[model samples]
Target: MRDRIFRRGILPIAVVAALSAVAGCSASGDTDSPKGSAAPSGSRAGRVDPRSAAALRAVEQATVRAGSARIESSTAMGGMLSLKTDGALGWSGDQVGTLRITYTGGQLAATMRALSGASMEARLLPDAYYAKVGDTFARRLNGRHWIRYGYGDLATLPGGSGAYLTDQLRTTAPLQPVRLLRACGDVRRVGEETVRGRRTTHYSGTVTPAALTGEDAAGLRKQLEQAGVATETVDIWVDDRGLLVKKAEQGELVGGRMSATAYYRDYGVQVSAARPPAADTADFKELMSTRGS
Candidate 1:
């Protein structure tokens, strides 16, 4: 029972983490703005509003400058899974962070609990992620408690090439919405709204292929094409101080629809996530090899 649970649960957590990481990365594009002044509203259907563009640029610069933030998110991958993550992520240099992830509701939740308890601590490093599983899981693996999943290893997983799971893990940050805004078209203001009790200005746009240009945009477009996503809708709510308060993205994937909503706060907060002790760690590749044998 424990072995079965371990096999089923650990794979799903990795899948969920990869998917979530890709979702965050897919929304971002090149941060460079086209040289020009802000255009008047309603100037052209395809033209981005000057104020909206400026707001996006400001938020992007501010977020990158802030370095780190507290992130809370809910993600649903069609009917495959639904999960919640509460954590702080730092993007000052390398993508270092930690997330307490829980399978709130899904077919995989029970299996996850059986293997890793009700929650898992994911420690993110520059080249890999480490998952701290429960004792039941540890006992099955020579008392190794942490599973190290290198990004390169993840790239070889099923459907990984198009998913950009590895690339996203290495490059994407919590402030991806601002990057999305840089390449967005049909940008429009949806008026002021309250997000998490804070007043914010809402903006929405479509991520069309034509709207995205440049080398970075071209790279993202290829990934989207490979993933069977023609277009995606992105919305963001920015606080008065030019910080991203909330963001939501919706798009269709090969299997079904995918959507995620995330809230950000406490910008500039310090976040330190240390790798697990080597003595109690197991490399995911070695575990997979053992299972295959």
Candidate 2:
């Protein structure tokens, strides 16, 4: 890639595109991006069953109580971008973790290839996140191997991607999907199914912007409204212990169709993501400055 194109803002645009698709995930170490839309599986919100509501409430509580988990997820944005991520996240309070993100296909894949080959490490923290850049790309970044995306800086993003920064910061916790499902209110038990050899109870529901609860609800509401997404399908499978075992969400965006599936295991696992070396890190906004990028 030409230095001028990159400095002219290619990387940030790519980051924004990837962020909008994932809703709040960072391109590198900040892979805790938590929600993806799915096909609607049950009745509308107005007629929720008492049994289903109670069960869902249990899941929400159990998941949050677990505190942390190992996560493997895949996300796709229509024909634009697709990726797989495996990471550990902790959310007893502020979300924190690290993920290995691999670009599998779509428009963003090419840019990621130029930036960091197929995959790179992402470290998520409470106040900011970091993405690892490849060696050659690091040279362009003045030998900095890490890019820091401060939570506050996210608001300056050019488009809708900026709107979900708060959600990502607040909801990218391991238990976010279950929290969203419980908050949705209109849901049903989709029966029990086996997941990776374990028996699990499945639940499905619709997530409308208005039904959104938890971190950054207003921002997410506006994001869906701006995207013209009236409703999206969300499905979750919970093990007998009330812990979420798998989650799938599918929805539409202004750019194209988007979907994500995530699997969770090893709850109560201790996870940590120490910040990268300050000497080797560059703030994202620093790259946008009128200085040598």
Candidate 3:
């Protein structure tokens, strides 16, 4: 039933109504860059080279500098469609949700939870977050509360159970935005492709740090590694305007291995007035500021 609806491709519709939130350009951490050669003496106008690495580096660096953003993401995998699991693995293609992330000064503060057909809202916050899951108001002060109180980290893991285990491996590591981009290493240009009838650039890459610190994260990574799961391959399609319009991943999820893809379109980045951060809430000023933390 869910697959049937997704097959119709409602992502474009979701984008129109401000329900879609996943869009990002890759960037690397600011490191020491090599100085370019000095211009020839007595030449007011220097010859411009378009294909130089310096030019490409300048563009890449510009994309990164215009960072610190919030965007929506919709992902669908296999678990929910297969009926083997409730889609806890994050591989369910029908699994749809919104992610609100703010990267301020290179630090990441994020909260992402999925809303499925079951009318359930499972949220993961960077600091403290409260959820009203069908009238059940629950709140967590830190990451530990996410274990039983919220949906397992979705960004770290691969598939459903496998991704959940992957979350366990990186749970202790600060979920940095730059780190996420770095994990998605070497996004080589695969020429242009059409997504939803729109021309977009295609790039593929892999994730890094198969294992991380912390008990829950470490144990999960160990379990999956011992299980001999293969690494994940990511495919991305970006429009001529530099917006990510589509993304796909192929990986394993416990006994069932599958491939999942998400197509993005009419990409616009904005914060929903209906779902503002906790700081913007009426009672937030009286509670605590999400700014300092």
Candidate 4:
């Protein structure tokens, strides 16, 4: 029962991490030119609507500078898994954060409960992610309660964005929505909206393969294509202080539709996460190796 449970639960959780990383990666924008084709007439220097461009730039700068935020998000990966997470993340220098992830529904959730538990605490650090499992899982793993997945190991996963996933998780997850808005080729104002009782300006755009640029841009594009996502729609709402208040991404992946919505607040909030005790933690790589053996 222990081996069966571990085999079924561990990889799906890892997929959750990869999916979260990929969702953030979708937000990388072209910082050099924020005036794609969505600019309005009389806009500054022939750029897209000067207001739109400026707003995006302002939000981007402010978010990066603030360094930390409280985040709540829900993600659905086709019919495979559904999850909700709430936590605080800091990216002032190195990525550090913690999230309480609950398996709300799906086959993955059932397996998770059978193996570990319905909820887990995901601890994020510069080099790795750690998930705290239930007592049953701990007993199976020589009494270790946490599973560590190092970014270095994720880079070797089979996929076009495998390497990019590692880089994005470590460097870009904090301000991904702003990055996506910056990279949009057709950004448009969607009027005013209220988010969590706070007024905010909404913006929407499509991120196509051509809009991406960078060393890993080509690879990411190919990965998206393979996942059946030729173009992704990204929307963001910015608050009065030029901070991202909410963001959403929708696209097709793994032969099914995938979508995620995230809310951000408490900008500049102080946050920290410490690695689990070595004696109580198990490395994911070692687990895989043992399973293979």
Candidate 1: how many backbone clashes? 0
lDDT of 4 by residue, 111-197 (tens): 666555777788888888888878976887899998887887654344444455555456535466556546544677778888789
Instruction: Give the TM-score ranking, best first.
Output: 1, 2, 4, 3
Q: TM per model?
A: 0.84, 0.84, 0.39, 0.82
Off-target runs (Cα >4 Å) in candidate 2 are 1-43, 211-220, 226-228, 291-293
lDDT tens digits by residue: candidate 3, 1-293? 22222233221112111111122111111111112211122231222233322323333443343332233333322232211111111111112223332221110011111212222332323331222221112222221221121223222222333333223322311112212223333334456667668886554443323533323344434433543444444455555555445544444544344443333433222212123344422222221223134
What is the alpha-carbon lDDT of model 1 when measured against the actual structure?
Answer: 0.67
Write one digit per residue (lDDT tens) for candidate 2, span 1-293: 53454454445444433333332222211222223223343446656688887887787788778888888877776787777878788888877888788889987688777787788788779888788888878897789999888777766555555545545555665454555566666677777788889998877777777777656466556655755566666677789999878777666666666677677889999999999999999887666563442
Stretches > 4 Å off in candidate 3:
1-77, 80-117, 122-126, 129-131, 135-188, 206-229, 264-268, 272-293
Error of 2 at 13 (Å): 7.6
Lowest-scoring 10 consecutive residues by lDDT in candidate 1? Answer: 29-38
Q: For model 3, give the RMSD to the true fold.
A: 16.4
Give the lDDT of residue 129 in candidate 1. 80
